[model samples]
Target: MSSVKKVLEIQRETIPYLYEFKDSKLTPFSSSIEEYKGQKQAYVVYSFNKPETEQGSGSRLLYTRIYPNESAVRTTGDFNTELGEKKENFTLNEIKWSVYEINGTPNIHLKGEKDGIVYEIVTQEVSLREVKELLATFISN
Candidate 1:
């Protein structure tokens, strides 16, 4: 189970250095991605400067409720591939778009159904060193 010790809101100017992010593994991200947000918990997302990119466009921000001892859930719509585009293996289906997990418990669905759909992905425990590499991958000028 995951816990949100505190809900710390970080302004854009105060965004943590990409090098400072620790924990959580860096999943294979698209090269078109413009920016990414690495939160303490909650959810992760990226936004695009222009419209979007199929390779690695949009912003990636990680978000989670900073509740103490309470499990938090993140939901994505997968609409228009705002968060990401369809992979070579995966197709866009109601079931494929949803992200549900147990950390939220009873009825917490990551990538909630409706706004788009929900695809529950098990977040692998990440090491600080590994995070550094992820930060490097998401870099764009």
Candidate 2:
């Protein structure tokens, strides 16, 4: 099993949020976690193994929301159809999330709702420099 690293932990309102990072065995990529303005909102972007394809490579942008003393609902789906011609090289499967395009950039949107309280998280593209900076800040904090 791959070792997991706890990068950051913070509380938003009553719910506590945690961020973890791990390396992908199938690719040279790593996933990063980020939080939004509201408490209980965060997202994780990672490259996952796609056993259905010969290359065994795929990407997953997951958004999650945590509720206070309640269970959260999660929705996920594939966006390859919406990706149009860009869907050639990759086989999008087991998609249980949604994607939205804003200002020409595609973002994965994940939401959790329970007892009338909702938490929203968005997934963004990860970069090596950004990850280094984030880890440095996390370590310093």
Candidate 3:
């Protein structure tokens, strides 16, 4: 009897507090702010996955954003929107401490400190169905 080989491969990259999944060449959205001379400090975190068919286009699979000291995750360009082209902001604070997904949509999870208080932020987006299927497979095995 002969046995077949099953292989699972995942590619990940990190660059200065940013993370990219799937294709390495895809651009990640990120930004930050610094305080000087007792001035107020601010920070921003964002990322998204480009569509497989379109490269360098603004069509994103999962979009996430976080402002300094925010307790909720803000998202734009959700999949559920008509035509998936609307750039509206949505917030997710139901779950804390983790970025989660349901049926392909993504919820970005983050943590930050402000005014001596630590809080968690979770942003949600409607991702492509294929992405959800891939996640399901990855998790099942």
**Could you give candidate 1's per-residue lDDT for residues 1-141 as a string of tens digits?**
111112113221232321112324332232111222433222333221223443442233332211112223333343212233322232232222234333422222233222221223322332223322443443211
- At residue 92, candidate 2 shows an lDDT of 19
Local distance difference test, candidate 2: 0.33
lDDT of 2 by residue, 18-119 (tens): 322333422323223333444353333334343456442254333333343243433344322233122112111111222333334555333333344443
RMSD of 1: 15.3
In order, how many clashes per candidate?
A: 41, 5, 0
Model 3 alpha-carbon miss at residue 28, Å: 3.5
For TM-score, candidate 1 versus 2, the one ahead is 2
Stretches of candidate 3 exceeding 4 Å from the true structure: 1-27, 34-42, 52-141
Worst 10 residues of 2 by lDDT: 87-96
Highest lDDT against the true fold, candidate: 2
